[model samples]
Target: MGVIEDLADALARDVLEAQAELGDDRFYEKMSKVLGELSPTTQEAFMTSVRVRLAEKRGRDFLARMLAAKRSGGAAPQAPRGPDSGH
Candidate 1:
């Protein structure tokens, strides 16, 4: 990755950790606002990193739930729907 991507990724990781530790779900928004004052490109990259990481985490959690339900002979969990999902 390029310098911007690397820096954005690192910032994303830190923001996520801080959000969890501080129980501040809006941390990403706040960080984005701060980044906006710096550079649009950097802010975009950081938001992209944050979105990808969050999506992957949600997917993993959904998978775990599905597996657990299957092991217990329960109905498989429904797939998660994102905001863009028509249903």
Candidate 2:
């Protein structure tokens, strides 16, 4: 994916995090407010931008960069996993 798609994924993660912080009702209201701030033209442009980004090669490149950084003395943070992962 390209920058736009990466941004969207990051946004989705953020939304999920926010939902966890604020309940479903508040989350909806917050989303509505944030999205409402943008014009319809902006929304359409944003979606197209993300769609183009999603069509690119980004995830693998990003993962490789992160792993390389980790091997080159970067800290390896432990990630949280779901219960189905045999933890």
Candidate 3:
């Protein structure tokens, strides 16, 4: 990821962590206050960066799933049956 995307990711993680620490009751207010403090351009850039990162992550996940399915001969994997699973 480029510098902008990297920074955006870090910022996002920080915001989420803060929200978790503050709990659901204050999450929205804290997020709104932080977002409100940002310049419009910065906010736009941050959003764009975050979107790009998400796309990349999803793309990677898709590729991994595809590879796993291919390795299993293009069939969906079956879960192992246990003694209690009724086979």
**Clashes per prediction?**
0, 2, 0
Across residues 1-87, which tens digit of lDDT does each residue of candidate 1 receive? 999999999999999989978899889989998998989999999999999999899889999999999899998988867699898
Q: Sort every candidate by lDDT, greatest first.
A: 1, 3, 2
The candidates, ranked best first by TM-score, are: 1, 3, 2
TM-score of each: 0.89, 0.34, 0.51
Error of 2 at 79 (Å): 30
Q: Give the TM-score of candidate 3.
A: 0.51
After superposing candidate 1, which stretches have Cα over 4 Å from the reference?
Answer: 82-87
Please give, for residues 1-87, the per-residue lDDT of candidate 3 as tens digits: 766556656775565456657766345344544665865544555666455655676677777877899898886545446689887
lDDT, model 3, position 82: 69
Distance (Å) between predicted and true CA of 46, model 1? 0.2
Q: Candidate 2 residues 1-87, lDDT tens each?
A: 766556545654465456656767245345534654864443444444444444343555667777987889987544446789987
Q: lDDT of all predictions, in order shown?
A: 0.93, 0.54, 0.61
Stretches off by above 4 angstroms in model 2 are 25-33, 36-87
TM-score between candidate 2 and the true structure: 0.34
Collision pairs in model 1: none
Clashes in predicted model 1: 0
Show pairs that collide, candidate 3: none
